[model samples]
Target chain A: MALENVALEHVPSGYGVYVGFFRDVTNADFLHQQLLSRNRDFEYAFIDASSVISRLHLLSAVYSALNTLLVGALRTPNVHSEIVTSFNTNNNIADAYRRWGITPGKTKDLIVVKIISPTAEGQNGFSATSARTPEAIWAHLTEHVMGKPVPVTDSEIAQATDWPKVRKYYRLNGVPALEKVADKAEHQRKMEQLAIMGMALRGL
Target chain B: MAVPHQQQHQFPLPQILTHPSSSPALLITQGAEGRLYKTTHLFPDRPCALKYRPSKPYRHPILDARLTKARIAAEAKVLERCWREGVPVPAVYAMDAANGWLMMEWIEGVPVRQAINEYLGSGESQEGQEEAEELGDLMRRIGRVVGALHKTGVVHGDLTTSNMMLRRQEGEQKGVLGGEVVLIDFGLAMQSMSDEDRAVDLYVLERAFASTHPRAEKLFGMILEEYGKSFKKATSVLTKLEDVRMRGRKRSMLG
Candidate 1:
C-alpha cells in the first residue's frame, strides 16, 4: 500500500501527528533510508501534503468545536480545572506543530493530525478521530467530547480536610483526595450527633 | 563611623553591666522594660549606653518577643530619623531587640531639669551668677529643641526636663559654658500631624517646669518666646495654651 493510504489507529485525541512530504518516491525513499540508518524506529512515507490534509480535515473540524466548548466551560463559574486541562492539551497540540517542520516560509507542506483522548476518569470513553491540522485537533477536543472526570488522589482528600498532617499522611496532591479525607472526617465527627440522637430516643 | 569614646563605671552585676575592656564605665538605669548600663568603647575609649530589655513574666513568650522586636526597631528608627533631621538626640550604638535593650551614646552631662533646679535654687556653688545666666540660655535652647521636634512631626509624648540632657562639651577651658541640650527617652514617641498633640507636649513641659524649677513661670516665658521664634506655627498653640492653663486640664460640670 502507498504511504499516504496507510492509517495508524488508537492515537490519542488532541495529540498532533506530523507527515513530511517529498517530491518523488525516490527522494522520499532516500530520506527515509537516511533517517533509518541514523536511528532505529525511523518511519517515513511517500505522499503529497494534500492527502494528509484531507485525512486530518474532519479531525480538525471536531477539535475546533471541542476547543470552543472547552473555552465556554472554562468561562463558567467554578470550572477552573476544566480550563487548565484544556489549555494544557492545546499546548501539547501546538508543540506537535514544531516537531513536524511546518514553518511559515517552507515550500514543503507537512500535515499534522491531532488525537484527543478523553481522560480515563472522564465519563466519556476513548474515541479515535483524524485531525487535518493542529487547530482542527483543538476544536475536536473542545466541541465533541465531554471532559473526562479527574481522578481523586489521597493527597487531594487530605488537603480538603484542612488537616495538613492528615493530607500529608495520605500523600494526596489533588482536590479529590482532600475531599475524601474531609468526608471521612466529617462522618466520624457525626458520632456526637449519633449520641444526641440516642439520648432523644431513650427519652422517647 | 567614628568609634565613640569609652566611659567606665563600677557596676555590681557583671551580666547586666558589661565593661568594655578599654573603659571601666558602669551602665546603671532600671526600667520596666530592662536594665540599662553605661560603658565605653573597647578600642576607642568613647562613651556608649547599653539598654537591656528584660523578659516580662506577665506576657506570653511569643508576645514578649514580638513586642521587644518592635520596640527596639521603632526606637532605633526614631533616633536615626531624629538625628537626620538635626535633632540633638543620642546616636544608637548597638541594639538587641530580642533582649529588649538598645545601647546608645552615653550622654556626658546632667539632666536639664537637675541642672536648672541646681542653678536656680542653690546658685551658690556650681558657677556663681555666670552659671545662672548660662542656665537662662540653656533653657531657651531647650525651647528651640522642642519647637524643632514639633516641626518634624515628632511629638515627645512625655516632655519633661529630666528627659533633656545638658551636656558640657569635653575638654573645654571654661567651666560649664556652652552646654548642649539633648533630648532622650523616646519610648512613647509617635508620628503625628495634630497641633493638639503638639500643644499637649508643650503643656506637659510647662507643667514639668512649674513643678521642678523655682520661679519657673518667668523662666518658661523666655523659653516660650524663643520657641515662638523657632516655629512659626507656635502662635495658635501658645493661644490654646492659655486656655489650657485656665481649664486646668480638668473637665468642668458646666460643659
Candidate 2:
C-alpha cells in the first residue's frame, strides 16, 4: 500500500514507474533540500498533490514524459524532471517546478514518482532488470517521508486537490465546456479531462 | 513466426504503436495527410484515435519533418481550442507534434455522411414528416456545432459530412440520423475571425452536402438557418456565404 508499480499501457517493458502518495507531509523542507542538493537517493519527481486533479491527470503527464524519454527527446535533466515539467501547459520549466513540484511548508500532501530505467548503469549496456525494486522504493519512502501513506486512487487524490490552483494551472476556469455540465461528478470529470488535455497539448 | 500480425498493416506504423500493449493497435482509416489507428495506449479500458502523419519521401528530410510537426501541432491546437469552447469535437488525449502523431478521444458512432445516407436510402417513397423532422434536427445540430466552432475563431477548412460524426447517446434507442453531432478531421483547420473565411467554410459544406446527400439537399437550408441564429456575427457570415456561392469559393478578379 506504500507504493504502486503502475503498469501503464504502451510503455516499454524495460522501464518501471512507481508512484506514492503521502498526506500531511511534515519534512517537506528536508526532502526539498535533498532534491536541491542533487542527492542520488532522491531521484524522484516530487509533485505537489494540490495541483493534480486525478490519477488520470497524473498518469497522462507520466505517459508524456515516458514518450519523450523513449524518443530521446527529453528536455529536462532526467525523466523525473520531465515528468514534473510535463504537468505544465507551457515551456516554462521553472514555473512548472514551482507550481507542481514539491515546495517547503506550502505542499501538505505530496505525490512522488520514481522512474527506474533499464540502462541505469550504462556501462553494462541495457541491463535486463530494473535499477530499483518497488519494495525497496516503498520501504525507503515510508522510512524517509514523514506523512501518512494513502492509496493513489482518484478519490484520495481528489481529497488533496486544490480546485482553484488546478483551474488556474490548466485554464479550466470560464471554459464553456465545463459550464454546460450540470452534474457534479460529471463536472469534475470534465475538469479532469480538460486538465489532461491541457498537459497533452503543452507548448502549443 | 513471432507476431505475424504486424505484417498485416499496409503501411509501416509510427514508432509509438510498435510498443507492447494489452490490446493490438488496429489501423482504422488512411487519409492523404495521415493514418488513423485505434489503440488503447493511454489506458487499457480507454481507447483513443492516434493520427500519425508519416514523413514524405519526395521532400527533403528536414523539410518533411518540419511540415509534419507543424501540421500535427496546428491540428492539436485547433482541437483543444474547440473542445475548451464547448464545441462538440474530440478532446485531445496526448500528442507529440515533433513525432508527427496526435492522440485524440475516440468518437463512437458513424460518420454523419453514413448516417444521412442510411436515412435517405431506407425508403424509395418520401420519408414521413416525423422522420423528416428528425433529419432536420440533425442538421440543426451540425449548424450549431459549426457555428460554435466559428465563434471560437477557428474555421474547419475541410467541412463535409465525412468530417463530422454523430456520437451515439448511451440510453437513446438506436436510430438513423440520431445522436449529437461531433466535428472531426481538423487537419486543414486554422484560427480565423474573418467572415470571408467563415463563409468559404459554409460554402464548402453546402457544395459537399449537395453532392454527398443529393436526395436531401433541400434540407441544407435548415442548417444555415440554425447557424444564422447561433452567434452574434453569424448573420454576416451567412450573408457572405451568399456571395461565396455566387463567386464559387474564390473572389473574382474582374476589373
Candidate 3:
C-alpha cells in the first residue's frame, strides 16, 4: 500500500517508475529465488536498502539504468539488473550485484524498484493493458514479500543506511574534500555528491 | 521551398532530448564541438546543463565514435579529479560517453567576463577605491581556484573568463562580485603534473584576462599573487609562466 509512483525529470511519460520500501524483510530468500529463477512476474530491482545512501542516490541509479535502457545500451540481462549494476563505481557487474543486490539473509531492509517502460512490456510479449499496472505490481509485492511496508522517503532510507558499507562501496573513506567539512549535513551532502560522481565516472 | 525561418534555424534535438519531460529543453549555446542545453537531471527541481557532442559528418563513423567517446570520458575524468580535490567546479551529474553527452550541476550567476565588465562600466572614472578592492577579491578567488586545480594534477587546456562562472553565495546580496568562482568548460582538460603544463594554463588565462577585461588588466597581478600562495610548487610554476609569457603559448611550432 506504501508503493509510490515516482516521476523522474526528462524520463519519457510512458515509462512508469514505481518504488516501494520494506523494513525487516522476512522473505528475502523467496524474492532472491524468484530473481535467480528469472520469474517474469518478479522483474523488479530488489536492492539492499542498507547500501543505499538516500532517495536522491537511489533515484540516480534508477535514472542511469533507465537511460541505458532508452539508449539500447543495457549491459545486464534487463533494466532491473542494470539498476543494480549502475550503483557500481566500476564495470565489474558481479561486484555490483554482491554489494547492492539483495541477499537471502543479509538484506534486512529492501527497496523494490519496478520500471514499466514500453520496451520492457513489448519485449516481454504483453499487451499494454495486461502489462502490470502500478496497483497490480503493489498487490503482487505485498502478497509475496513479507516485510513492513514503509514510505520510500529520505528519512526512511537514512534509517536503513549502513555508513561503513556505503563508504567502502563508494570509496568515501578519508577523502580530503569530505574530511575538511566540519558540518554533519554538509558532510553527508558531499558524500552523496562523491558517490554519485563515482557512479557517473564508472569505468573511466 | 519556403520553410519557416524559425523552423529552419532550429537544430534537431539529440536522441535523448526527444523524450517527453516536464519542460522543454532549451538550447543555451552551440560550439564547434558540442551544444549545451538547460535541462533537468533526475528531478525537475534539480536543473543541470547537458552537453551534447554531435557526430561529425566529415569523419568516418568508426573514428568519430572513438574520438567522441574518448573526449567525453577524458573530460568527465578530469572533472571528477578536480571535484575530489575540492576545486570549485561543477559536479558531474550523469554522462553517456558513448552517446557523447554529459550532464553536470547547473551553476547559477553570470560569467566572470560579464561580472568584470559590469563592475568596470559602472563608473566613467577608471579608479574607484571600493570597486577596485572588490575586483581584487574576485581575482584572488580565481587564482586560488586555478591553483587548487593544478595541485590536483589537472590542467584546464582552455582557461578564459568566459569559461569561469561566478556562483552566488548563499544569503549573499545579488549582483555583487563576492561569491565562489567555479570553473567550467572542461572539454579540453587533461591530467598533468608538468610545470610547463601548469604555466601554460596560467599564461592562457593571463592572455584571456587581458583581452577580455582590458580596463582592469592592472588587477591581473592580484590573481598571480594569490596563485603563488595557494600551493607549495606555485612559485616554480609562476617562474615557468614568465618563460611561457615570453615565447607565447607555443614552445616550438612543430605542428
Q: Which TM-score value belongs to model 1? A: 0.48
RMSD list, candidates in order: 28.4, 2.5, 3.0
Better of 1 and 2 by DockQ: 2
- Cα misplacement distance, residue B223 of candidate 3 (Å): 0.9
**Regions of candidate 2 where Cα sits further than 4 Å from its true position:** A120-131, B1-5, B123-127, B253-255
True contacts kept of each: 0.00, 0.83, 0.77
Predicted chain A of model 2: TM-score relative to the true chain A?
0.94
If chain B of candidate 3 is superposed on the true chain B, what is its TM-score?
A: 0.93
Point out the worst 10-residue segment of candidate 1 chain A by lDDT. A195-204
Model 3 per-residue lDDT at B171: 86
Model 3: fraction of the reference interface contacts it also forms: 0.77
Q: What TM-score, computed on C-alpha atoms, does each candidate reach?
A: 0.48, 0.95, 0.95
Candidate 1 residues lying further than 4 Å off, grouped into runs, are A1-204, B1-25, B41-44, B123-133, B173-177, B247-255
Between the candidate structures 1 and 3, which one is better when assessed by lDDT? 3
Q: Docking quality tier of candidate 1? A: incorrect
What is the C-alpha lDDT profile of model 2 across A54-146, one tens digit per residue?
A: 899999999999999899898987788899999999999999999999999898999999887776453222223323888878877888899
